[model samples]
Target chain A: MENFHIDGSTYIPRIDFNAETGVLEIEGESYHEYTTEFFGPIFSWLEDYLEESGKEITMNFKMSYFNTSSSRRFLEILTLLEEYQNNKEGQVVVNWYYEENDVDMLESGEEYADDVELTFNLLPY
Target chain B: MGYMEHFSVKTFKQQLAMKKISLAFQGIFSQDVLALIGKSLRNTPESRVIAKRLFAIVIEMAQNIHHYSAEKQYSEKDGRDIGVGIVAIAEDDHHYIITSGNCIVKTEVPPLIERANYINGLSPEKLKEFYREQRKAPQREGKPGANLGFIDMVRKSGNPIEINIKEYDETRSFFILSVRVNKELQN
Candidate 1:
C-alpha cells in the first residue's frame, strides 16, 4: 500500500497516512476551492487500500478550522471508511483533535459522528 | 418594498462602491478579480486575515442573496446577486470596522438577530470555544444552511459583531452587522 502526504497551511491542513500502521493524520485549516476534486484521489487511494490490504485503519484528524465544502468532503471520507468497516474488511476509528477550549470543533465532530455508524473520538490537543 | 428595489441598478452600484472601500479589494472587476483580490489582500499583514474571512463570508452572503432575495438578474459573469446590499470596511480610532448590509426576508431577521446577540455576548476566548463546539457538532439538518460561515467570520475577525435590522417592508427586512478589530490587537 502507498501512503499519501499533503503539506500543511494556515488555511488548510497537512495530511499523512501511514500504510504500515493504517494510521491517517490530517491537520490544518480546510477551506479549499476545488473540493471533491482534491479529495477524490485520496478517497480512491483509501478505498483501494482497504479493499486490497484488508488492514485495520485509524485516522487522527487535528484541524484548526475548515469550511463547509471541506466539511462535506470529510463526511465523504468518513462514509467511505464506514463502508470499509461494514464490509468487514477491517475496522476504522476516527480521532478528531481540537483545542480544549474550542467548542465549535467539538460540536462539529459530534455532528459528523451522528451520521456514521462508526465511532468518533473527540480529543483535545 | 417594491420588486424593483431588488433589481435597482443602484443596489449593485452601492455594493461596488463598498468594494472600493477597501483599496486592496476595490477596482477589481474582471475574470481574475477573485485572484486579484486574493493577491492584494495577501500582501498586507492585517488585511490577509480579513481577506480570507471575506472570502467565506461574501460567498455565503452572495448565496443568500441568490437564493432568498425576492428578485432576479444575471448581468455579471457569475450572476451577482440582485439583492440590495452593501459591504464595507473602514478604519477608526483603533480598529477596522467591517460592515455588511442587505435586505432579508422578515422570517430571516429574528434568527440572525439572535445570532448577532449570541455572538456579541461572548468574549474572544468564548467565541473561540463556540467555534470549536460548532465545528465538532454534526452539521445542522442541511450542511450549507449551517451558520458556520457567520460564526467563522466573527471568530476570524477577532471583533465584536454588531447587527442592525430594519423593515424594508412587512415581508422584507434589512440586516446589518459591523465589528471592529482594535488596532492594539492587530499587527
Candidate 2:
C-alpha cells in the first residue's frame, strides 16, 4: 500500500507514515483551523494499514506543540492504536519525544501513557 | 468594574511600566499577529521551561480570541475574518501573569464562568484526571476544539485562574482571564 506524508504548515503539524517500514512519525505543532479535516485522512490510512498489513507498527510523536483541538484527536489516535495492539498479533509501540527542559511536554506524554494500555517511551532530547 | 472610555497609548504605556508588562496587544487577532507575538516571546533569552509554558498559554489565549471573540474584522488582503481582543503578559517577582480579554455574547457568560470555576476548583491530581476525561470527550458542535483550552490553561498555570466579566452592552460583555505561572517552578 501507499505511505502517507503531509508537509507542515504554519498552524499544522507534519505527518509521515511509511507503510513498508510500519513507522508513523508526527512532528511539529498542530492548531489547524479545521482540526478534523486535517487528521481525517491520516486516521483512515492508519486503520486501513493496520487491517490490511497486519504488521508491527511504531508510532512516534515528536510534536513541539499541539493545541487542545489537536490533542483531542491525538487521544483518538491512541485509542485506535490500543485497539490494534489488543486484537492483532502484531505489536504496537509508541515513542513520545519532548524537549529535555519542557516539563509540560514530558508530563503530557506521561498523561497519555496513563490513559492508554500501551506503554510509552518518553524520551527527552 | 465599569467600562472606561479613555484608552490611549500613553495610558497603556503607564500600565505596562507600572505592572512590569512584557508584551501587550489590543487589536485584531489574526494568525499573522499571533505569529509575531510568538516570535517575540521566543526572542527573549528566558529559561526554555518557562518559555514553553508561556508560549503555550499565549497560543491558547490567542486562539480563543481568534475563534470566539465577539467583535470581528474582515481583512481584505487575505480574505480572513479576524477577532478584536486584548492580551498582555506581565512578570512579577514570583510569577508571570498572562491575561487575555475579549468580547463575548452575554448568553455565553454563565457557561464560561461555570467551566472556569470548575477548573479552578480542581486539585492538580484531579485536574489531570479531568483533562484526560475531557480529552476523550467528543468535540462540541461548531467548536473545533474539545472545549479543553480553559482546562489546559488552568493545568499549566499550576494555580487557579482569575477571571472577570463586565457588561459592555445588552448583547455583549468583556471577558478577561488571567493565568499565572510561578517562576519558582522553573528552578
Candidate 3:
C-alpha cells in the first residue's frame, strides 16, 4: 500500500495516510468548493484498508475547522470507522485532538462518539 | 477606497497587509465581495491561506444571517438565502484581521453574543478541548447545521477568535466578528 499526502491549504487540511503504519492523520482547515469531491478517495482508502486482516489502524484528526458540507462527510468517515472497528479483528482507535480551550471542537468529537458505535478517545494537544 | 458607499450589493477594495490588520471589514459582505476577495488572495501564499480561513468564517456568519435575520430574501441561486452583511480583510506586520458584518434582531443577538463571549475567552488549548467535547456530544438545537463548520475553521486557523456587536435599526442591528490570525504562530 502506498501513502497519500496532501498539503494543507487555508480552506483545506493536510492529509497524510500511511500504508506502512496504518495511521491516517489529517490536520488543518477544509471548506472546499466541492466538499464531497475531495473526500471521496479518503473514504475509499479507509474502506479498502479494513479489508486487510489484523491491520491496526490509528486515525488522528487535529483540525481547526470545516464547513457544513464537509461536516456531513466527516460523519460518514466516523461511521465507516465504527463499522471497521466492529468487524475487523485488529484494534482500531480514533484519536480526536483539539485545542485545550475550544469547547466546540471537543464537543464536536464527543457528538461523533455519541453517535458512532466505536469508542473514540478525545485528546487535547 | 477613501469613502464609504451605500448600495444593495458592493465589493471591498483589495489590500495587501504585511504586519497587522484590524478585525473590521468596511465593505458589503455580499457573495460578490467574498468572491472578489477570494480572487485577490490568489497572488500571495499567506494571504491565500488567510483568505481560505476567512472564507469559512464568512460562510458560517452568512448562514447565521440567512437563518436568523428577520428581513431576508432568497437569492437567485434557487433557494439559497442571503442576508445583508460586510466583510473586511487587512494585514500589517504581525497579524491578519478578518471582519464580518451582518444585521440581526435584538432577540437573536443575546444567544450568539453569549456563545461568542464564551468562545473568545478560551485559550487555544481549551478551544480544542471544547471542540472535541462538542463534537462528541448529542446534537443541540441550531448546532448540527452550523457549529460543525465553525469549529472546523477555528481548529485549522492558528489565531484568536474575536467578535463585536452593535445596533443599527429597530428589530435589526449589526453583528461583526473579527478574527486575528498571527503570522508568527503557524508556519
Candidate 4:
C-alpha cells in the first residue's frame, strides 16, 4: 500500500520498495550493527505486499558487498520471494547485479540463485 | 619478561616484517573506527576489486569481535556495547594477511578451532555448497550467526583460514584468526 525508501549509509544499503511499481530494489553494501532490527520491517513489508497486491514483483539487488549477518538476511529475502513465486499467481523475478570484474560477487549471485527456486538474472555491469 | 609475552612480541614483530604491516590496531573495536579504516583502504594499491575483498574480510573479522568478544565495554555516546579486540592488515608482494583477535570463553575455543579447520579443509566447490546450505539453515540461538561468517571468510580469502588460541586464564582465552587474500587477484 505504501512505498519504502531508505538511503544507504556507511554500514547499510539503500532500500527502495515501490508499491505502485511493484518493484523493490536494494543497493550498496550492508554491514549494519543491528541486522535483524534493520531488515525486520522490510521483510514484513514484502510479506504484506505479496498478500495485498495482485501485481507482479521484481526484486533487484546491486550490492558491492555485505557482511555475514546481512548475507543471511538476503538469503531470507530470497527464500521469501521464492515462496511467493511458487504459490502466488503474480510473478516474481530477481535480478542480481555485480561488477563485471568481481568474480566473488558474481559467484555470490550464482550461489543465491542456486538456493532459491526462482530464476535469478545475474547481471554484471 | 614472561615467556608468553616475549614469545608473542617476537612473533608479532616477525609477522610485521615478513608481511610489511599496512595497518594495525589493538584494543577497542568500534563501528566508527572500522568505517574509518574501510575508508582509508580504498586508496590502496593494485585494484579496487581486491580492495573490496580485503575490506569484506576485515569487516567480518572485526564484527565477529563486536558480536562475540568476551571482553566488552560500553560506549559513552549511546551506551552501546563495544568489544575489545585486535585487528591488523599486512601485505607482502603476493598476498594480504588480515588478522583479528578477541577474548573468548575458554570452553568456546575447541569448537571454534574445529570450525576453522573444517572450513579450511573444504574445496572451493564444497565451500560454496556449504555456504549456501548455511545460509538457508536456521540461526543458532545466542550466536549472532549460524556459523556462516567463518565460511564466508574462508570463501573470500581463497586460502586456508589460520587460527591460533592462547589461554588467558582459567575461564578465558584469546582467539586469533587470519585470512589471506591473494594480491594477484588485484590484477
lDDT of 1 by residue, B1-187 (tens): 8878669878776865765455322222222443443445455454334445545454444434433444445447644534445555666555556666666778877887787778877887687567556655665553243446566567655666777877687777777666655544342
Estimated TM-score per prediction?
Answer: 0.55, 0.90, 0.56, 0.91
Best by TM-score: 4
TM-score of chain A of 1: 0.92
Residue lDDT tens for model 1, A1-125 = 67888887544479898888889988876654444556777887877777653668898888866666587678778877888888866688889887775655776788677778887899997
DockQ per candidate, 2 decimals: 0.15, 0.63, 0.16, 0.62
Writing each residue's lDDT as its tens digit, candidate 4 over B34-86 gives 78888988987878878888888888888888888999989775368888898
What is the alpha-carbon RMSD of candidate 2 to the true structure? Answer: 3.8
**Residue range B1-187, candidate 3, lDDT tens digits:** 4344563222332222222333333323344544445446545455444545555666665545544555566667534555556555666576656666777777877876677667767777787667656655554554324355445546555554566778788877777766665654353
Comparing 3 and 4 on DockQ, the stronger one: 4
- What is candidate 1's local distance difference test score? 0.63
Better of 3 and 4 by lDDT: 4
lDDT scores of the candidates, listed in order: 0.63, 0.84, 0.64, 0.84
- Model 4 lDDT tens row, A19-124: 9988899999888866888898998888888885346889999998888889899999988777777777667889999989888889888888888888689999
lDDT (Cα, 0-100) at A36 in candidate 2: 89
Distance from true location, Cα of B136 in model 2, Å: 1.2
TM-score of chain A of each: 0.92, 0.95, 0.92, 0.95
**lDDT measured at residue B92 in model 2 versus the true structure, 0 to 100:** 83
In order, the interface RMSDs are: 6.4, 1.5, 6.7, 1.4
TM-score for candidate 3, residues paired by index? 0.56
Backbone atom clashes (below 3 Å) for every candidate: 26, 0, 61, 0
How close to the true structure is residue B53 of candidate 3, measured as C-alpha lDDT?
53
The segments of candidate 3 whose C-alpha lies over 4 angstroms from its true place after superposition are: A1-72, A87-125, B1-39, B45-52, B66-70, B141-144, B148-160
